[model samples]
Target: MRQPMIDTYEEAIEAVRACGILPLAPLIPDHPSLSGITLPERWHSDTELDPWRWRVRFPGDGIAAYGKFMKKKAILVASDLVPSVRSLLGSSRSIAQRYGDGLISKAAKEVYAIIEEEQGIETRALRAAAGMKAKESKKEFDQALAELQSGFDIVISGVRAPRNEAGEVNGWNSTCFETVEHWMEGAGIPLAPMSADEARSRLQARLGEHSSPQAMAYFAKVFGF
Candidate 1:
C-alpha cells in the first residue's frame, strides 16, 4: 500500500495534495519553509493544501525540525519515515499500549487486524499476542504527550526559524502554539492560568470533588505552567 517515493519537493507537494495532508517546512533563503514564509513566485500551486501551511525540509537537522513540526500538526506518520513493520512493532505501538488501553482502542485493533490479514499473518498467534500486549500497556498517551512536549519545546526555543538576514529569529515565534491557542480561544478554553488552589476550586465546582493540591500542581507542571 506504500506509494512510490517522490524524488523532488514539487512531486512531494503534489502527493501531499492528493493525500489531503498539508506539507509545511521552515523558511530559508535558498530553502522552503511551510508556514508563513514567502515562496518563490514561480513555485505556487493551486492545490487544496495551502503552500503557506507547508514546511521546509532542508538537509541535516531540518528533518528533525520537520518531524517536530509534523508532530505538532498531528499528521506525522511514523510509517512514512520507517517501514510499517518497524513502526507497528516499535516503541510507538508500545507507548500507545502503555498510557491507557484506550490508545489501542477497538478501532485501532480493527486496523491492525486488517494490516495483519493483508500481510498474510492474520492467523499468527504471536502477532495477535503482541497486538494485545500493546493494547494492555496504554503507552500511547505518554508517548504522544512526550512528542508534543518536544515539539512545543522546539517552538518555544525559537530554533526553527522565520529568520532574519544573519539567520537570527526576530522574536519568540511558535506556529504550533499560535495554532493551538487560536483553536482553544475559538473553542472557549479559558486563557487564564489558574493557581493550585484556584484550579482545585474550579475542579470542585465542575466535578463536586476537589483534586488534591499535589494533583493540581502535577497538572500544572504537565501542562507547562
Candidate 2:
C-alpha cells in the first residue's frame, strides 16, 4: 500500500479518525518499506517522501483533537476506536480475573494504582509516585508500564513539552498516562456495551481478511481477541 502524506495536523486527525486503527508508523511486516513513518518528527521536514512528519504529528495532536493513545498489540493506537476496542478485548470481570490469577505483577499493580489515584500523570511523575525512581529499577518500571498497556488498563493520553524561562519549548515531549476509562471520559468518547465474544469475533473477521492465519493468531494473543 502506498503511504499517504499528511501535510497538516487537521489532515492527520482526519486520517486517524477514518482508519479506526493504525500503526504509529507505516509498518506492515509483510509489505515492502518504501518510506519511513510519521508523528514524532518535524511536520513539514519531509525533504524526502517519508511519513515521519505525519507520524510524530498525530499522537499529540490527535489526543488534543479527539482521540485515545494506547499500546495496542505493542504498537501505538491513536484513534476514536479505543472504546469499542477495549470493550472487545477485556471487561472489568476479565481484568479482575487476570489480577486474581496473579497475571498482573506487583510492580504493574503499583504503577496502575498510582495512575488511578492521580487520574492522569506524566511518566516521570508516575515513576516517582510508584517509587520506582532508581536507575536500576528503570527496566522494571518500563516493563510494568508496558504490561499495563498490553493488558489494556492504561494509555498514553497526552504529551508534555517543557518550556524554557523565555517561554520556548524545550526537550523531547514526555508522555502522559491515564486509565482507559478516564482517557475515554476526558476525550468525550463513549463506550458501546458489547459482549467479549462478539467483539473478538468481529475483530478476528476484520483482521483475518488482511493477515495470514499465523499472523491472525499472533494478533489474537497480543490483543486478547
Candidate 3:
C-alpha cells in the first residue's frame, strides 16, 4: 500500500493506521526505512493535533509519545496496538528488571517519586520538584526520563500552557507527565490485549514489511524488536 501524506494529526493518525507505527521526526526524519511519508515532522505540528487535543480526542488512540523504535523522545503507534507494544516490550518486566538491576538511577527515582505523588505535573514543575533544574544534572535527568518512558512507566499526558510567575499565560504550553495508568485514565485510552510474544512478533512483522532488510536488522539490534 502507498503510504499517505501526513501534514496534520488526522493525516498522522491515518499514517499510523497505515504504517502501524512511526518514529518522531527528530529521531529519524523521513522514518528512513518506512514507506511513503511514514512519519510526521511533529505530532504538535498544528493546532488541530496538539497533545492536549490528542488526549481528549483520541485518548487511548494509539500514539506512543514515549516512542519504542528508538531511544528518541517520541514515536507514534496505532491505538489498538499500544497494549500489545507494551506487552511486547515486557514493560512490566522491564520495570521490575530496572529496579532489580538498579537501572533506575537516583535522579530517575526522584523524578518517579514526584510523578507518583502528584499523579500528573508539567515538565517545569516536574523538573523543579525532582530537583533536576541544575544545568549540570540535565544529562542525567533526561536519561532517567527516557528510561522511564521507554520502559512504559511514565508518559506525556498533555500540554499545560506556560504561565508567568504571576500565574498568567506567558509562553507556549509545557508537556505534562503522568504515570501510564494515570494518562490512560485521563485520555480514556486503554491497552489492546495480546500476549507478550504475540505483541513483539506483530510489531516485528510490521517493521520488516515497512523497512529494508538492512534497516530491519538495524531495528532489531537497536530496539530489540
Candidate 4:
C-alpha cells in the first residue's frame, strides 16, 4: 500500500500524532512508518524530513515521545499516548526487581546502572562506562541497551556530536540515553491512568481503524499487543 505523506518535521510530528505509533522504519508492512511516507532520498540528509536524523533527535519537541518501543525498533508515540505505551510495554518493577524476575539480563542491568549514574549519556560513552567497549562486546552491549529501552527503563533523550579538542563537532552524532523519568522531566508528558490491558485495547482499536486485518495481525504478533 502507498504510505502517507510527510515532507517536513512539522508534518512528521502531525503524522505521529495522528497515527499514535509510528515506526522510524518499516516493520509491519501496513503499519504507519516515517520511512514509508518520506522521500527515500531524504533519509540520511540531516534535513527536517530525515528519518535517520529523527531517530537521533526526538528533541523533546513535545509532539511525540521517541523510544525503542516496538520490538526493540525505534518508534514515535503520540505525546498523549506516552503513558499508555509505557503501561503496555514498560515494567513498573525497578531494574533490580526485574533482574530478579529473569526478565532483565545481567548485561542489561549493567547498562541501566550506567544510565542511572549518568543521565543522558551517549551510546558510546555508555558502553565504555559499562565495560562493553570492545568490539566483541558490541552485540551484548547493544542488546542491553535495547533491553532497557524496550522496558522503558531508559529513553533516548537526544543526541551529541563528537567534539574536537577545539570543542567543535567532529563526527557523527551519538544518541543520548536517560531514564524515562529523567527524560520526562519538564517535558509535560500526558497524564492518563491507563492499564496495560486498556492500552492494548486502545491500540488494537486504533490499528483496526486504519490498518488491514493482515497488518493488524502482524502488529499484534510483532508488538505482542
Best by TM-score: 4
lDDT of 1 by residue, 10-40 (tens): 6555444332222254322222223323344
What is the alpha-carbon lDDT for the whole of candidate 1? Answer: 0.32
Task: Go through the candidates in order and give each one's C-alpha lDDT.
Answer: 0.32, 0.59, 0.60, 0.77
lDDT of 2 by residue, 1-225 (tens): 233656455655554544434555444444212133244455346444334433444444434222222343334444444655676544565445667788888888888888888875878778988888999999999988878776668876666676679989888666777787776676666655777777677666655555556555556775587
Clashes of each: 25, 10, 2, 0
Question: What range of 10 consecutive residues in model 4 has the weakest lDDT sum?
Answer: 184-193
- Residue by residue across 33-97, what tens digits does model 3's lDDT show? 12235333434455764433453233344344443324654666555556666665435553445
**Positional deviation of residue 39's Cα in model 3 after best superposition, in angstroms:** 12
Q: Score candidate 1 by TM-score against the native.
A: 0.23
Give the clash total for candidate 1. Answer: 25
Instruction: Put the candidates in TM-score order, highest first.
Output: 4, 3, 2, 1
Q: State the local distance difference test value for candidate 3.
A: 0.60
What TM-score does candidate 2 get on C-alpha atoms? Answer: 0.69
Models 1 onward score TM values of 0.23, 0.69, 0.72, 0.87
Worst 10 residues of 2 by lDDT: 64-73
RMSD of each: 20.1, 5.1, 4.5, 2.4
Give candidate 2's error at residue 21 in angstroms: 1.6
lDDT of 2 at 150: 65
Model 2: per-residue Cα lDDT at residue 121: 81
lDDT winner among the candidates? 4
Q: Comparing 1 and 2 by lDDT, which wins?
A: 2
